[model samples]
Target chain A: MRQFTATYKLFLQHQITKGRLTLISVMAAIAVLLGFIIGSSGGDTREGAVVLIMGYGINFGVPIIALVLASSSFGQLKEDETLVYLWLKPSSRIATVVAAWFAALSAVIPAVAIPLTITSLVASSFDFSLAGPTFLAISLAVVAYSAVFSFVGLVLKKALIWGFVYIFIWELLIGNLAPGTSKLAIKTYPTSILINMTDEDINGDLTGFFVSTPAAIITLVAITCASIALTAWRLQETEVA
Target chain B: MTQQPPPPSSSQQAEAWPPKDSTIVARSLSKSFRGGLVALSELSVAIGPGVTALLGPNGAGKSTFMRLLCGLTKATTGDIWVAGGNPRKDAAVRGRIGLVPQQDGIFERQQVYDFVYLAAVLHNVDDPQSATLRALELVELNPQELTRPLGSFSKGMRQRAKIAQAIVHDPDVIVLDEPLNGLDPKQRRHMIALFHSLGEQGKTILVSSHILEEVERFGSHIVVLSKGRLAAEGDFRSIRSLMDHQPRKVKIACDKPKNVAARLIESSSIASCTLHDEETFEITTADAGAFRKEIAIACQKSDSLLSEVTPLDEDLESVFRYLVGER
Candidate 1:
């Protein structure tokens, strides 16, 4: 337990550096600013919100932010060669792996959530109903993205570049039109949750793409567990010093 | 002083290398990386309690072997045991082995105290704060300096901070890979003293270095490595003798070098001489100490003033080559 907390605290410090905090703040403000511009422009506010939410948030902004933050959890440590300080200890590898996953969350949640909330609300022309779905969707997205990226960070070299490819090519572009690959897409879960909860009038490319809420939740939860397990196993096998 | 045992054969190494009271043992260890780079070959040796130096030239697999000992890397073959447990297989065994790595990658944003304290907590020490204080004190880092971030420290202080973190948990076996780098002479002396004290406490402390003289100061016991293999192990004297008795080139700077070279050519110790200019010359000597005594006498006879005398082949690579060749 102490080891877990120690790893958690250190990883949190890594995430909340002044430079990164400023970068995340800028990204959040820009996302909100884009949402506000479309909402007040008077051309179908709900559709604009969906474009920003599904197009930018789900497909681009959230995953990219989560990728930089999550992958850096172990990536930066290994690059700096400081991983040996933690790796040579007697503590359980899962403790460190689990703690790193949560610490990435500790910053990732707040960094991605508030902007998403303000973006949806203002973009929906002060629709308070948008808050519930926005929060739930972003919450699920960040947790799932953070776990997968953390494992990717551990196993893959140049993981940030590879993660970018996965998000841009596989998740957004291919998952949009191809139903077979879309079944494997992570964004489908959160997007389905938003479509089901936000508004019955919410319709577009998402009309035929929605999975049931329970199924979506179960898949995301399963991915998080599986990613964490793989990370722990790789942690033991890695030759770090 | 421990006497040199006969060089053990590959088959005999298992029985003859590390004796009964070995604290760390590696048998037939080999590690290879991509591109066919073999860092450590089929080398085997055992180290017991005390400050035994891990001596080798750069790229002699000292760091690789140390990483293997600390469980930071897996062995390509064979086995290694620290305190009767394999650190790679047993997480609990890592608590007993503390490592001071050579890489300069400490937490730069963190204060020295916090870094060492983190190591203490991770090792599950009973009281991290107290252990941290004791470790910092042992390394002689000032209390006021503890609050400063590690990035702001000079190289020497950073080295001390690294030493503090390694000792914070008071592990039974400590592996230091090139720990003396960046330290000034005074800090080096203090560090040697601290290692001596740790050795007296019956801890197995292995300090690795490429420089022969640096290893000599830590203690007479040394495991000399060359090209990923054990070249020699035992007392420092045997190795020192081999280094001293080699035919080495000595350069002398003096007024009237030609006359002095003429006088020195009479002696049997001077195997050959090359007069470079009006005031300088070089000699290849079969007997270094005898040549030193003869040069002064020859200079006086020729009425020449001697300015300097320096050895040319004193680099560690050559010494390692000599050892490897001799063995």
Candidate 2:
């Protein structure tokens, strides 16, 4: 709890003054504003729907935020040579890592989720029934994606590059082209949930792009748990090199 | 040849008084990184109370030894105990020890009070507010700086804040790895005084430093390391006596160097003398104080003024080189 409070204080400071954090928040706001403008244009509903979809896609910013936050989590300690102090402290490593992850996650989730939700509501005419489930799916997606990226952030020195590759190359390219690989992408499960909730027909003929409801929930839970477990294990095993 | 007194017994030596009843013991500790880069090699030492200075040059395993003692990294093959428990297995042991690492281990964006208070809370201190205030006072930080972000602090202020955080929990033993690194002369003096007070308060402190004079000021017990080995251990006087045969170099600047040199050569106390220039001479003496007094008397009798008399071999580097054999 002490570690959590300390890390949260650090996050609050970063959210207020850090340029990159401000940039991410601004980009999220701009993306949401663009979505609302296009959704309210009232010419072609399909185009408006496309804009809303883009807004949802911009939810990728959550993972990016996680990457940025986690990249510095332990890396900053090493760079500043402050790990020695913490390593000598009586606090548990698991507690510290978890606290840092949650702190970073808190900074990011709201930036992406709130903006996206507000835009979707204003643009789509207050369809709470549709928006509610979409929000749920998006939140789950944020948590799952952040967890996985946070683990990657701990493991790799070049976490931002790896995070980009994971989003663009692995999720976009391979998950789209190879039907079998889609299940591995976090977007696959949440998109499935969103599709089920909104009755949206995405990738019409792309069988295996989506899975059953139970499988989606199970996959999300499994991946989240596994990423957290990996992070804890890595914290214990790897020396602060 | 002259015979010297035997070194003091272990019981006659100053005993360290730990703030609490706990002994930090290490036996046959060794550490080697990948590619066979050895950091500590079969080194062993015990620390109980008071300020024990771990003196060593760079890469002499001071940091590595601290890490091993704190259980930050596992010893390749050895055993360590702190507070009657294995540091690796016991979190309670850590609660009794405070570590101030070489680098300022602080989140600079946070305020000073918040940082120190958070550390106290993390260490399970019952009253964080009083603990934080006490710690700030201990470091002599201005109360106004408690509300300011650490990033804006000067180097000495940051170091004091770091020390404040390290001791907020009031641990029995405090390990400071190069606690005086970048401080100015005033700050250094202040910190040295602070260390002495902490020791007087009965907190066992293990401070590491490469600077001999700084360590010499407050180091009640000294453990010297050279190339990852325990080169010397015990009080400074005992260690100095170990190198009794090492000649002391004295420089004399006088008006008549040749006359002084000629006069000094006749005395058995002078081992050798060299003319540095027309007005200066360097002499090797077995007893530095006695030789300096003799030179002063000789100058007075010859009616010559002695401009300067200095001991060149009094510094630690000279003693270290004599003990370790120059690399």
Candidate 3:
């Protein structure tokens, strides 16, 4: 338990010192501003709804932030050669990975979720009841994306490039162009959650392609579990060098 | 020092420590990379209490052996046990052993105290704050410096901090890979003293260094590796004795080089002597002291001036060359 606390503290220290918190804050502020401008702009209520909908679409920021944050956690271990220190500890590999993941997730949650909730309320001028589900969906999406990207970061040396390709080429491109590939992309499932949260009557066309909320929720849970398991396996098997 | 019985044969030594009782034991360990690069082959060693220096030159398989022992990489074929258990399966083994890696690994943005405290936590040390403080004090790091960022530290301070982290948990064994690589002479002296104290406390410390002199300072037992094989292993004097018969070089600048050479040759102490210019001769002697005395007597008899007499092959560089052959 002490080891876990120490590892977590180190993770937090690394995140704070690396300017991750500051970066997250800046991104969230930009996201909030973008949400407000798009929400208030003159358009049909349905079009204005898509604009207001962009706040919940903060799931888009989830993979980007997670990819950047998660990819370097273990790579930094390798670069510093501090993996030996961690490896020599009495804690299990799974525990170390989980501790790091939880620490990073905790730091990023406030960074991503707080701005999202604030922006959603400010931009739409929406009631708490209307924003609640969207907030929950975005929060879940952040955790799911963090887990998946953290796994990628732990396993690959070129995780940043690979993460970029995953988000841009696979999630954005193939996810839109093909239905099968969309199921494989974490973004597609979270986007479905946002589609459910938006006023379906006002924006039927935009939400048409998304799966049901229950199915999206199931996918998110499954992917989160799978990502954590894969990450644990990688953490155990991978050599420090 | 009273000599213990000759160390058990490699195989017997491997099995002597109860698999469940030894701090570390490796038997017939071998590892090879792709492209047929054998990093270690049939390497066997057991490490217990006190400091053991893994002495070797560059590319002598020290790093590979360390990685194998720590279970950072799987040996191609062998068995390794740490604290009476397989390290690969037991995370607890890591807690029992502390490693100070060769690289400077502190996070640039982290305060020194936080960095070491984290290591204590990782090792599951109770009361991490005090443990961290104690570790810092052990390394003799100033208390004020603890709050400062590690990036602001000088190279020597960073090295000390690295040592602090490794011992923070107070593990039974600490492995330091080139722990004194870049320190100035004073820092090196401090580290040597620190290692000696650690050893006196009965902590098993394995320090790897290419510099023989540095290893000689702290290592009670030494293991030498050359080109991925165990070149020699034991006390320094025992290893030194392996090259006992190697020709020792003597440089003499005397008034009568021919007379000195002749006396040395007559005594059968010198294998060969080559006169250089008028006053100097380089003699290869089997027994340097005997040849020196013989030359002294001959010079006195001839009333010849003996300007300089020096043993050219008495230092470590010559000893290493004689033992391992010049690269």
Candidate 4:
């Protein structure tokens, strides 16, 4: 547990640099601004608000921020060879991966959540109901995305490039329209949870493309667990110093 | 030091090689990378608790062997026991091994204290802060330098900081790979003293270098590696004597190179002489000490001033070549 705490502290110290904090603030502000514009332009109309939040905020902004944070969890350290400190420890690989995953998740949550909550309130005509559910959905999304991306970061060489492909190609393009392929995309689960929980009157509805609420929750948990497990296994088998 | 007798009818006795008191034992170790490049091939040796210098050229698999011992990587085919535990199978055993890698992997944005402190905590030390500070002091890094970001540090300070991190946990075995590469003469002397102190404390110190003199300062115990194999392992004197028949070159810069070279060649100790220039010449000598005395007398008789005399082929690579060729 001390090892975990130390690793967590080290990861956070590396994460909360001035430049990254500023980037997070700017990204959140921009997402909120986009939400405000969409809400005011179509005043009290839930369809325009839903379209903007789903299309721009959830689909694009949240994933990008999550990807950056998660991919950098072990990627940057491995690239710089500073991962040796953690790798040569008496602690289990499971602890190391868990620490990195939690660090990335914690860092990504606030960065993506502030904008998401603002978008939710503005889109819901100042109604405070959707904020809680939206934040919950986004939090789950960040957790799953962070773990999977962290795993991808460890396993792949050019993880950032491949993360971009996974987001833009698999989730953005195929998951929306393609029939069989959409099931393979991770965003489908969290998006389903969001669609089911958010105000239902919005006309730009993406509810049909999602799985059931229980299934979404199960899949999200499964994805997080599987990714963390794979990361630990990969760390044990592979050599990096 | 007297060797401890092997435990009779024990499982460890079956695999023990190069002796019973050895802290690290590698038997028939080999490592090959993805492209079928064999970094280490059928290597076998045992290392005891002392300052044992691992001498090798650039591609002689020194780093590969060190990494294997550190358990940073596994051997493709052989077994290694470090501190009575297999590092590959036991993660906790890593706490007993400290490695100063050859690569420059400084956390540039972090302060020196934080960097070393992190290593201490990861190693599960009882009190990381105090251990970190003690390690820093051992390496002779001042308090002011500890607070500064590592990127702002000079090469020597960075190297010292690295040493601090490696020793912070007070491991049983410390493996330093080419640690003296960038240190100045004073820092090198200090580091030699530090290594000797650590050895006095009964820590197994395996320091790798390609320079013979650097290893000579630490102690006589030497391990020569060449082309992914153990060429020889023993005291430096014994290893040097193994290649005693080879002609050793000594270059001399004198006032009258021609006359001094002619007089030096007259002695039986001098095998051959090559005049490099008007004031400089090189001589192949079977006996370096005798040749040195002979050269001084010859220069005095020739009325020539000998400015400098340097042993030209006393490096680790040359010795490795001789040993490998003999094998």
Report fnat for all candidates as fractions from 0 to 1.
Answer: 0.90, 0.51, 0.84, 0.76
Q: Chain B alone: TM-score in each candidate?
A: 0.74, 0.80, 0.79, 0.76
lDDT of 3 at B43: 76
Compared with the true structure, what per-residue lDDT tens digits does model 1 show for residues A139-158? 89999999999999988889
lDDT of 1: 0.86
- Among these predictions, the greatest lDDT belongs to 1
- Over B94-175, each residue of candidate 3 has an lDDT whose tens digit, in order, gives 6677777777776777789988888877676778899999999988899988899988999788888888988898887788
Model 1 ranges with Cα > 4 A deviation:
A43-47, A199-201, A204-208, B1-17, B238-321, B325-327
Q: Give all candidates' CA lDDT scores.
A: 0.86, 0.72, 0.73, 0.82
User: DockQ, in order, for the candidates?
Assistant: 0.62, 0.33, 0.59, 0.55
Q: Rank the candidates by TM-score, best first.
A: 4, 3, 1, 2
TM-score of each: 0.84, 0.83, 0.85, 0.86
Indicate whether candidate 2 or candidate 4 has the larger TM-score: 4
Evaluating just chain A, the predictions reach TM-scores of 0.94, 0.85, 0.87, 0.92
Model 2 regions more than 4 Å off: A11-17, A37-59, A122-125, B1-22, B86-89, B249-270, B274-317, B324-327
TM-score of 1: 0.84
Q: What is the C-alpha RMSD of each candidate to the true structure, in Å?
A: 6.2, 6.7, 5.0, 5.4
**lDDT tens readout by residue for model 1, B168-202:** 98888999988889999999989999998998899
Model 1 clash pairs? none
Query: Model 2 over residues B158-275: C-alpha lDDT tens digits?
Result: 8888888889998877888888877888878888998888887888888998787888787657877778888876675667656656777889999988888888878888999999
Q: Give the C-alpha miss distance for residue A199 in model 3, angstroms.
A: 4.5
